[model samples]
Target: MSIELDHTIVPSYDKLASAKLLAELLGVPWSPTALGPFAPVFVNEGLTLDFIQTDEDFPVYHFCFRVSQQTFDDILGRIKRAGISYRSSVRGPVDMRINTDYGGNMIYWNEPDGHQWEMLTVSYARQSA
Candidate 1:
Protein backbone atom coordinates (compact mmCIF):
# COMPACT_ATOMS: atom_id res chain seq x y z
CA MET A 1 0.00 0.00 0.00
CA SER A 2 1.17 3.51 -0.72
CA ILE A 3 1.11 6.24 1.90
CA GLU A 4 -0.35 9.65 1.20
CA LEU A 5 -1.26 12.72 3.20
CA ASP A 6 -4.99 13.25 3.48
CA HIS A 7 -5.31 16.37 5.63
CA THR A 8 -3.86 18.43 8.45
CA ILE A 9 -5.12 20.81 11.11
CA VAL A 10 -3.73 24.34 10.99
CA PRO A 11 -4.35 26.48 14.02
CA SER A 12 -5.22 30.09 13.41
CA TYR A 13 -6.68 33.02 15.27
CA ASP A 14 -8.99 33.84 12.38
CA LYS A 15 -9.85 30.75 10.44
CA LEU A 16 -11.75 32.24 7.55
CA ALA A 17 -9.35 35.09 6.89
CA SER A 18 -6.32 32.88 7.17
CA ALA A 19 -7.84 30.28 4.90
CA LYS A 20 -8.86 32.89 2.38
CA LEU A 21 -5.44 34.49 2.40
CA LEU A 22 -3.75 31.17 1.76
CA ALA A 23 -6.16 30.28 -1.01
CA GLU A 24 -5.67 33.58 -2.75
CA LEU A 25 -1.91 33.49 -2.39
CA LEU A 26 -1.62 29.96 -3.72
CA GLY A 27 -4.25 30.56 -6.39
CA VAL A 28 -6.23 27.62 -5.12
CA PRO A 29 -9.92 27.23 -4.49
CA TRP A 30 -11.10 27.27 -0.88
CA SER A 31 -14.48 27.11 0.74
CA PRO A 32 -15.92 26.95 4.18
CA THR A 33 -16.82 23.41 5.16
CA ALA A 34 -17.80 22.30 8.62
CA LEU A 35 -15.60 19.48 9.78
CA GLY A 36 -16.51 18.87 13.37
CA PRO A 37 -15.36 22.10 15.06
CA PHE A 38 -12.85 23.02 12.39
CA ALA A 39 -13.23 25.06 9.21
CA PRO A 40 -11.31 23.34 6.46
CA VAL A 41 -9.78 24.91 3.37
CA PHE A 42 -9.51 22.43 0.57
CA VAL A 43 -6.23 23.39 -1.08
CA ASN A 44 -6.44 20.65 -3.66
CA GLU A 45 -8.31 17.49 -4.56
CA GLY A 46 -6.23 15.35 -2.22
CA LEU A 47 -5.18 17.87 0.45
CA THR A 48 -7.30 19.78 2.91
CA LEU A 49 -5.89 22.50 5.10
CA ASP A 50 -8.16 22.50 8.10
CA PHE A 51 -8.09 25.76 10.02
CA ILE A 52 -8.79 25.43 13.70
CA GLN A 53 -9.61 28.59 15.60
CA THR A 54 -7.57 29.02 18.71
CA ASP A 55 -6.72 31.61 21.35
CA GLU A 56 -3.95 29.87 23.18
CA ASP A 57 -0.42 30.11 21.91
CA PHE A 58 0.74 27.34 19.64
CA PRO A 59 3.82 26.45 17.69
CA VAL A 60 4.14 27.90 14.25
CA TYR A 61 4.23 25.38 11.43
CA HIS A 62 6.02 25.42 8.11
CA PHE A 63 4.37 24.37 4.86
CA CYS A 64 5.97 23.96 1.45
CA PHE A 65 4.37 23.70 -1.96
CA ARG A 66 6.00 22.21 -5.01
CA VAL A 67 4.65 23.99 -8.05
CA SER A 68 5.39 24.28 -11.74
CA GLN A 69 7.51 27.08 -13.18
CA GLN A 70 4.50 28.92 -14.48
CA THR A 71 2.62 28.49 -11.25
CA PHE A 72 5.61 29.72 -9.32
CA ASP A 73 5.92 32.77 -11.53
CA ASP A 74 2.22 33.55 -11.20
CA ILE A 75 2.27 33.19 -7.44
CA LEU A 76 5.43 35.24 -7.15
CA GLY A 77 3.91 37.98 -9.26
CA ARG A 78 0.82 38.00 -7.10
CA ILE A 79 2.95 38.20 -3.98
CA LYS A 80 4.87 41.16 -5.33
CA ARG A 81 1.69 42.88 -6.40
CA ALA A 82 0.27 42.40 -2.94
CA GLY A 83 3.41 43.92 -1.40
CA ILE A 84 4.06 40.78 0.57
CA SER A 85 7.65 40.53 1.76
CA TYR A 86 9.48 37.35 0.83
CA ARG A 87 12.91 35.92 1.40
CA SER A 88 15.34 33.66 -0.34
CA SER A 89 15.68 31.46 2.73
CA VAL A 90 13.87 30.98 6.01
CA ARG A 91 16.46 32.85 8.07
CA GLY A 92 17.71 35.05 5.30
CA PRO A 93 17.06 38.76 4.97
CA VAL A 94 13.53 39.79 4.16
CA ASP A 95 13.24 41.00 0.61
CA MET A 96 11.62 40.20 -2.68
CA ARG A 97 14.07 37.51 -3.60
CA ILE A 98 14.18 33.95 -4.85
CA ASN A 99 16.84 31.37 -4.19
CA THR A 100 18.27 29.29 -6.97
CA ASP A 101 19.30 26.52 -4.66
CA TYR A 102 19.14 22.90 -5.76
CA GLY A 103 18.84 24.21 -9.34
CA GLY A 104 15.30 25.45 -8.63
CA ASN A 105 13.70 28.73 -7.81
CA MET A 106 12.35 29.06 -4.27
CA ILE A 107 10.87 31.77 -2.10
CA TYR A 108 9.69 31.90 1.47
CA TRP A 109 6.98 33.94 3.08
CA ASN A 110 4.50 33.89 5.92
CA GLU A 111 0.74 33.75 5.82
CA PRO A 112 -1.60 35.83 7.93
CA ASP A 113 -1.28 33.33 10.74
CA GLY A 114 2.51 33.55 10.67
CA HIS A 115 2.86 30.09 9.21
CA GLN A 116 6.02 29.79 7.19
CA TRP A 117 5.14 29.04 3.58
CA GLU A 118 7.53 28.10 0.83
CA MET A 119 7.05 27.69 -2.89
CA LEU A 120 9.54 25.98 -5.14
CA THR A 121 9.60 24.94 -8.74
CA VAL A 122 11.64 21.79 -8.19
CA SER A 123 11.77 19.09 -5.59
CA TYR A 124 15.02 18.25 -3.83
CA ALA A 125 16.14 14.77 -4.66
CA ARG A 126 18.97 12.68 -3.27
CA GLN A 127 21.33 10.99 -5.67
CA SER A 128 21.57 7.24 -5.28
CA ALA A 129 24.99 5.72 -4.84
Candidate 2:
Protein backbone atom coordinates (compact mmCIF):
# COMPACT_ATOMS: atom_id res chain seq x y z
CA MET A 1 0.00 0.00 0.00
CA SER A 2 1.13 3.53 -0.73
CA ILE A 3 0.24 6.53 1.37
CA GLU A 4 0.04 10.15 0.30
CA LEU A 5 -1.75 13.30 1.29
CA ASP A 6 -5.09 13.43 -0.54
CA HIS A 7 -6.41 16.54 1.14
CA THR A 8 -6.65 18.29 4.49
CA ILE A 9 -9.69 19.30 6.52
CA VAL A 10 -9.12 22.34 8.70
CA PRO A 11 -11.35 23.77 11.41
CA SER A 12 -12.33 27.32 10.64
CA TYR A 13 -14.81 29.76 12.14
CA ASP A 14 -15.60 31.71 9.00
CA LYS A 15 -14.97 29.40 6.06
CA LEU A 16 -15.76 31.93 3.36
CA ALA A 17 -13.48 34.51 4.86
CA SER A 18 -10.82 31.92 5.50
CA ALA A 19 -11.14 30.65 1.97
CA LYS A 20 -10.83 34.12 0.54
CA LEU A 21 -7.81 34.87 2.69
CA LEU A 22 -6.11 31.61 1.75
CA ALA A 23 -6.88 32.01 -1.91
CA GLU A 24 -5.34 35.45 -1.89
CA LEU A 25 -2.37 34.25 0.13
CA LEU A 26 -1.66 31.12 -1.90
CA GLY A 27 -2.55 32.67 -5.24
CA VAL A 28 -5.26 30.14 -5.96
CA PRO A 29 -9.00 30.02 -6.30
CA TRP A 30 -11.55 28.11 -4.27
CA SER A 31 -13.75 25.79 -6.26
CA PRO A 32 -17.50 25.71 -5.77
CA THR A 33 -18.78 22.92 -3.56
CA ALA A 34 -22.21 21.36 -3.26
CA LEU A 35 -22.84 22.27 0.39
CA GLY A 36 -20.23 24.93 0.63
CA PRO A 37 -20.64 25.76 4.25
CA PHE A 38 -17.03 25.02 3.27
CA ALA A 39 -14.79 26.16 0.42
CA PRO A 40 -12.35 23.80 -1.23
CA VAL A 41 -9.08 24.89 -2.84
CA PHE A 42 -6.64 22.72 -4.73
CA VAL A 43 -2.97 22.69 -3.86
CA ASN A 44 -2.43 20.92 -7.14
CA GLU A 45 -4.29 18.23 -9.04
CA GLY A 46 -3.56 15.88 -6.14
CA LEU A 47 -4.24 17.69 -2.85
CA THR A 48 -7.06 19.93 -1.73
CA LEU A 49 -7.66 22.79 0.71
CA ASP A 50 -10.83 22.16 2.72
CA PHE A 51 -12.37 24.46 5.25
CA ILE A 52 -14.87 23.54 7.98
CA GLN A 53 -16.47 26.19 10.09
CA THR A 54 -16.39 25.11 13.72
CA ASP A 55 -16.41 26.52 17.25
CA GLU A 56 -13.65 24.80 19.23
CA ASP A 57 -10.27 26.34 18.39
CA PHE A 58 -8.34 24.05 16.10
CA PRO A 59 -4.71 23.56 16.92
CA VAL A 60 -2.47 25.60 14.67
CA TYR A 61 -0.70 23.55 12.02
CA HIS A 62 2.41 24.53 10.07
CA PHE A 63 2.41 23.78 6.36
CA CYS A 64 5.00 24.82 3.78
CA PHE A 65 5.27 25.55 0.07
CA ARG A 66 8.37 25.66 -2.10
CA VAL A 67 8.97 28.53 -4.49
CA SER A 68 11.88 29.82 -6.50
CA GLN A 69 14.19 32.21 -4.67
CA GLN A 70 12.75 35.09 -6.69
CA THR A 71 9.18 33.98 -6.05
CA PHE A 72 9.94 33.58 -2.39
CA ASP A 73 11.34 37.10 -2.22
CA ASP A 74 8.29 38.50 -4.03
CA ILE A 75 6.02 36.76 -1.54
CA LEU A 76 8.07 38.10 1.32
CA GLY A 77 7.82 41.53 -0.20
CA ARG A 78 4.07 41.23 -0.34
CA ILE A 79 3.98 40.15 3.29
CA LYS A 80 6.08 43.16 4.26
CA ARG A 81 4.01 45.50 2.10
CA ALA A 82 0.91 44.30 3.92
CA GLY A 83 2.47 45.35 7.21
CA ILE A 84 2.68 41.73 8.43
CA SER A 85 5.37 40.48 10.75
CA TYR A 86 8.57 38.89 9.42
CA ARG A 87 10.57 37.56 12.33
CA SER A 88 14.34 37.30 11.87
CA SER A 89 15.21 33.80 10.79
CA VAL A 90 17.77 31.78 12.67
CA ARG A 91 18.75 30.22 9.35
CA GLY A 92 18.69 33.44 7.31
CA PRO A 93 16.45 34.49 4.36
CA VAL A 94 17.10 31.38 2.29
CA ASP A 95 15.91 29.41 5.30
CA MET A 96 13.49 30.20 8.12
CA ARG A 97 13.00 28.46 11.41
CA ILE A 98 9.62 27.79 12.94
CA ASN A 99 10.45 26.82 16.48
CA THR A 100 13.40 24.50 15.74
CA ASP A 101 12.10 21.10 14.69
CA TYR A 102 9.31 22.15 12.33
CA GLY A 103 11.50 24.50 10.38
CA GLY A 104 11.97 25.29 6.70
CA ASN A 105 13.15 28.23 4.55
CA MET A 106 9.96 30.00 5.46
CA ILE A 107 8.13 33.18 6.40
CA TYR A 108 5.13 32.65 8.64
CA TRP A 109 2.19 34.51 10.06
CA ASN A 110 -1.05 33.80 11.87
CA GLU A 111 -3.97 33.36 9.57
CA PRO A 112 -7.41 34.71 10.32
CA ASP A 113 -8.27 31.73 12.53
CA GLY A 114 -4.82 31.82 14.13
CA HIS A 115 -3.32 29.05 12.00
CA GLN A 116 0.42 29.22 11.49
CA TRP A 117 0.94 29.46 7.73
CA GLU A 118 4.15 29.71 5.73
CA MET A 119 5.84 29.97 2.34
CA LEU A 120 9.31 28.58 1.77
CA THR A 121 12.04 28.83 -0.87
CA VAL A 122 13.21 25.24 -0.76
CA SER A 123 10.57 22.60 -1.11
CA TYR A 124 11.32 19.40 0.78
CA ALA A 125 8.32 18.21 -1.15
CA ARG A 126 9.63 16.12 -4.06
CA GLN A 127 13.21 15.19 -4.65
CA SER A 128 13.04 16.21 -8.30
CA ALA A 129 11.46 19.69 -7.81
Candidate 3:
Protein backbone atom coordinates (compact mmCIF):
# COMPACT_ATOMS: atom_id res chain seq x y z
CA MET A 1 0.00 0.00 0.00
CA SER A 2 1.19 3.52 -0.80
CA ILE A 3 0.50 6.48 1.46
CA GLU A 4 -0.26 9.87 -0.01
CA LEU A 5 -1.42 13.29 1.08
CA ASP A 6 -5.05 14.27 0.71
CA HIS A 7 -4.77 17.89 1.85
CA THR A 8 -2.98 20.13 4.33
CA ILE A 9 -4.65 22.54 6.71
CA VAL A 10 -2.77 25.66 7.76
CA PRO A 11 -3.94 27.83 10.60
CA SER A 12 -4.43 31.45 9.61
CA TYR A 13 -5.41 34.51 11.57
CA ASP A 14 -6.87 36.23 8.58
CA LYS A 15 -8.20 33.57 6.28
CA LEU A 16 -9.08 35.79 3.35
CA ALA A 17 -5.90 37.85 3.36
CA SER A 18 -3.63 34.92 3.97
CA ALA A 19 -5.39 32.86 1.36
CA LYS A 20 -5.03 35.68 -1.15
CA LEU A 21 -1.31 35.99 -0.52
CA LEU A 22 -0.76 32.26 -0.67
CA ALA A 23 -2.81 32.03 -3.80
CA GLU A 24 -0.58 34.61 -5.48
CA LEU A 25 2.59 32.95 -4.24
CA LEU A 26 1.39 29.52 -5.28
CA GLY A 27 0.15 30.79 -8.63
CA VAL A 28 -3.37 29.59 -7.91
CA PRO A 29 -6.70 31.27 -7.39
CA TRP A 30 -8.04 31.60 -3.86
CA SER A 31 -11.33 29.85 -3.35
CA PRO A 32 -13.08 30.67 -0.11
CA THR A 33 -15.90 28.56 1.20
CA ALA A 34 -19.31 30.10 0.81
CA LEU A 35 -20.43 29.30 4.35
CA GLY A 36 -17.33 28.35 6.22
CA PRO A 37 -14.13 29.95 7.43
CA PHE A 38 -11.91 27.91 5.22
CA ALA A 39 -10.00 28.94 2.13
CA PRO A 40 -8.83 26.44 -0.43
CA VAL A 41 -5.90 26.69 -2.79
CA PHE A 42 -4.76 23.90 -5.06
CA VAL A 43 -1.14 23.28 -5.97
CA ASN A 44 0.95 20.73 -7.82
CA GLU A 45 -2.25 19.95 -9.75
CA GLY A 46 -4.24 17.75 -7.33
CA LEU A 47 -2.85 18.80 -3.99
CA THR A 48 -5.17 21.01 -2.00
CA LEU A 49 -3.88 23.64 0.42
CA ASP A 50 -6.33 24.87 3.00
CA PHE A 51 -6.18 27.80 5.40
CA ILE A 52 -8.36 27.43 8.44
CA GLN A 53 -9.18 30.41 10.57
CA THR A 54 -8.95 29.87 14.28
CA ASP A 55 -10.38 31.73 17.24
CA GLU A 56 -7.17 31.67 19.22
CA ASP A 57 -3.68 32.51 18.05
CA PHE A 58 -2.06 29.72 16.13
CA PRO A 59 1.39 28.45 16.84
CA VAL A 60 4.07 28.40 14.18
CA TYR A 61 4.49 25.10 12.40
CA HIS A 62 6.34 23.85 9.39
CA PHE A 63 4.69 22.56 6.23
CA CYS A 64 6.38 21.19 3.16
CA PHE A 65 5.48 20.52 -0.44
CA ARG A 66 7.26 17.84 -2.41
CA VAL A 67 7.58 18.84 -6.03
CA SER A 68 9.15 17.64 -9.22
CA GLN A 69 12.64 18.73 -10.24
CA GLN A 70 11.33 21.01 -12.95
CA THR A 71 8.78 22.55 -10.57
CA PHE A 72 11.48 23.17 -8.03
CA ASP A 73 13.64 24.89 -10.63
CA ASP A 74 10.70 26.97 -11.78
CA ILE A 75 10.05 28.10 -8.22
CA LEU A 76 13.70 28.96 -7.81
CA GLY A 77 13.49 31.11 -10.92
CA ARG A 78 10.32 32.71 -9.69
CA ILE A 79 11.90 33.55 -6.33
CA LYS A 80 14.85 35.10 -8.14
CA ARG A 81 12.58 37.08 -10.43
CA ALA A 82 10.67 38.40 -7.43
CA GLY A 83 13.95 39.63 -5.89
CA ILE A 84 13.16 37.96 -2.57
CA SER A 85 15.96 36.73 -0.38
CA TYR A 86 16.27 32.94 -0.59
CA ARG A 87 18.73 30.84 1.37
CA SER A 88 20.01 27.34 0.76
CA SER A 89 21.82 24.70 2.78
CA VAL A 90 25.09 26.65 2.80
CA ARG A 91 23.58 30.11 2.94
CA GLY A 92 23.03 31.32 6.49
CA PRO A 93 20.76 34.05 7.78
CA VAL A 94 20.37 35.76 11.14
CA ASP A 95 17.05 34.16 12.09
CA MET A 96 16.42 31.46 9.50
CA ARG A 97 18.24 28.41 8.20
CA ILE A 98 17.74 26.50 4.96
CA ASN A 99 18.98 23.02 4.15
CA THR A 100 18.21 19.77 2.40
CA ASP A 101 17.25 16.60 4.22
CA TYR A 102 17.28 12.94 3.24
CA GLY A 103 19.54 13.88 0.31
CA GLY A 104 16.65 15.76 -1.28
CA ASN A 105 16.72 19.35 -2.53
CA MET A 106 14.72 21.80 -0.40
CA ILE A 107 14.13 25.48 0.14
CA TYR A 108 12.98 26.99 3.43
CA TRP A 109 10.78 30.03 3.70
CA ASN A 110 8.14 31.63 5.88
CA GLU A 111 4.62 32.82 5.40
CA PRO A 112 2.95 35.95 6.80
CA ASP A 113 1.83 34.02 9.86
CA GLY A 114 5.39 32.92 10.58
CA HIS A 115 4.68 29.33 9.55
CA GLN A 116 7.64 27.71 7.90
CA TRP A 117 7.14 26.59 4.31
CA GLU A 118 9.45 24.16 2.59
CA MET A 119 9.72 23.19 -1.04
CA LEU A 120 11.44 19.88 -1.60
CA THR A 121 12.22 17.58 -4.48
CA VAL A 122 12.81 13.90 -3.95
CA SER A 123 14.18 11.69 -6.67
CA TYR A 124 12.40 8.39 -6.43
CA ALA A 125 13.97 5.38 -8.08
CA ARG A 126 11.96 4.29 -11.05
CA GLN A 127 10.66 0.72 -10.89
CA SER A 128 11.05 -1.58 -13.85
CA ALA A 129 7.89 -1.64 -15.91
Which candidate number would show the highest TM-score if scored against the true structure? 1
lDDT of 1: 0.86
| TM-scores for all predictions | 0.90, 0.70, 0.69
**Cα RMSD, each candidate:** 1.8, 5.2, 4.5
Worst 10 residues of 3 by lDDT: 89-98
Which residue ranges in model 3 land beyond 4 Å of their true spot?
A: 1-3, 33-35, 44-46, 89-104, 123-129
Give Cα-based local distance difference scores for all models.
0.86, 0.66, 0.68
Candidate 3 residue 33 C-alpha distance from true site, Å: 4.7
TM-score of 3: 0.69
Candidate maximizing lDDT: 1
Selected candidate, larger TM-score, 2 vs 3: 2
Model 1 clash count equals: 0
Task: State how far residue 101 of model 3 sits from its true place (Å).
Answer: 7.3
Better of 1 and 2 by lDDT: 1
Predicted structure 3: lDDT: 0.68
Error of 2 at 79 (Å): 2.6
Off by over 4 Å in 1: 125-129
> Mind giving the per-residue lDDT tens digits that candidate 2 earns over 33-100?
63655688776677777988898867877666676667667666666676665544423453333332
Q: lDDT-based ranking, best first? A: 1, 3, 2
Residue 98 lDDT in model 1?
90
